[model samples]
Target: MGINTTKLKRGFRELFGKTVQAFIVQLRMETGLMLIENTDLSISEIVYRVEYSYPASFTQAIRNHYGKTPQALRCLA
Candidate 1:
């Protein structure tokens, strides 16, 4: 926590092979996917749970990451 912004970014990128933003998006998308697959929660609820402000954005993220819509993914599950 004491590190400067540049140093923190560098260290994080070196350790994680991606920027902090990418890592966070990856975590959110993964969590969203899990919820979609295993829970009965609605798409809007899942978007809120994943910290997205809009269902459309969350759906776009899911599509970008998995090449499937949330509903499509849920159907597979």
Candidate 2:
């Protein structure tokens, strides 16, 4: 799609009330949560599955977004 950056950002914010980066991280965290719930994948595995670079970064993102680490979330399962 020939998305113009200014328009795309504006449209995304209008539609979702969030920036693109926020939307992407939300998607990553949701997939990470589902993987934690349903799969026996390791934290690192889940991180990479969501296209995250490292375990700590993934951990921090999960913590920031959901207020729990991947391990802690898995423990809920």
Candidate 3:
């Protein structure tokens, strides 16, 4: 697209009610949660599947979004 970066950011936020980064993080977290809940994949595997290079960072993001660790969420599922 020929859209300016600033204008794209503005339009994205206006349309989604969140910054693009936040939206991406949210998508990653949601994917991670779905995997945790429905699959037998390990936490580290899920982390990588969500494009996170560091399991610690992915764990922290999950905790922040779901108030639980991936393992904890998996146990619940």
Candidate 4:
């Protein structure tokens, strides 16, 4: 089955609560995956494109959530 945008919107509303930081972090997670899966840009470029002020913080968050480095995930595809 595929995700519907309506369901996805509702899901995000429920999961992210009302905190702007939580919402932005979730957005970063999604954007990071899109960058890794769909583009040839390096991880640093992805970090900047996502508006993360600290590359190390973004890298750590990505690693903590996905259990893999961006470089490692790139190799999987």
Candidate 5:
């Protein structure tokens, strides 16, 4: 899929109170989806691409957003 720059930008503007937080949230969401779709790479590798502070943070965010663990999602796919 392509980047929905306009929609994403507008989403950030509305959903995030701050620009930086919005950017990071968007980064995390986008990267999380990439991680879900592509199983070739490890979660640790994907964590960095998403700019997560640590693996735990990435996993926590994934869990919070999807209501499923990364491993669970991977297995389902």
Candidate 6:
């Protein structure tokens, strides 16, 4: 196939207004929010399930993208 990682990532960002990684993270956040709102999964569990390599990084990404930590978001929900 002609699609390389760089081109694919660029196309994803062009089409979605976020890099592929960011978009995936966004999706994970959305779902995580839903889970937080509706389910009983612990924060750490959600972090791991979201595919972040570590809880700290996931918390950082959540803060960076949503302007809130996962715990804060859960509190808000």
Q: Give lDDT tens digits, candidate 1, residues 27-54.
A: 9999999999999999999999999999
Q: What are the per-residue Cα lDDT tens digits for candidate 3 across 1-77? A: 99999999999999999999999998998899999999988888998999999999998989999999888889899
**In candidate 5, what are the lDDT values of residues 32-74, reduced to their tens digit?**
7777677567877888877887989888888888888777777
Candidate 6 per-residue C-alpha lDDT over 1-77 given as tens digits, one digit per residue, 9 for 90 to 100:
78898898888888999987777878988887777677779878888787777889878877887899888888887
Q: Which predicted model would earn the best lDDT? A: 1
**Runs with alpha carbons beyond 4 Å of true place in candidate 6:** none
Model 3 error, position 52 (Å): 0.6
Residue ranges of candidate 4 with Cα displaced over 4 Å: 1-18
List lDDT for all candidates, in order.
Answer: 0.97, 0.91, 0.93, 0.85, 0.76, 0.82
- Deviation (Å) of 59 in candidate 6: 1.5
**TM-score for each candidate, following the candidate numbering:** 0.96, 0.90, 0.95, 0.71, 0.65, 0.73
Q: Clashing residue pairs, candidate 2?
A: none
**Stronger candidate by lDDT (1 vs 5):** 1
Measured with C-alpha atoms, the lDDT of residue 72 in candidate 5 is 78
lDDT of 2 by residue, 7-75 (tens): 989998999999999899889989999999999988888888999898999999889988988888999
TM-score of 5: 0.65
Sort order, TM-score high to low: 1, 3, 2, 6, 4, 5
RMSD of each: 0.7, 1.4, 0.8, 8.1, 7.6, 2.0
Q: How many clashes show up in model 6?
A: 0
Residue pairs in collision within model 5: none
Candidate 5, lDDT over the whole model: 0.76
Cα deviation at 22, candidate 6, in Å, is: 2.0
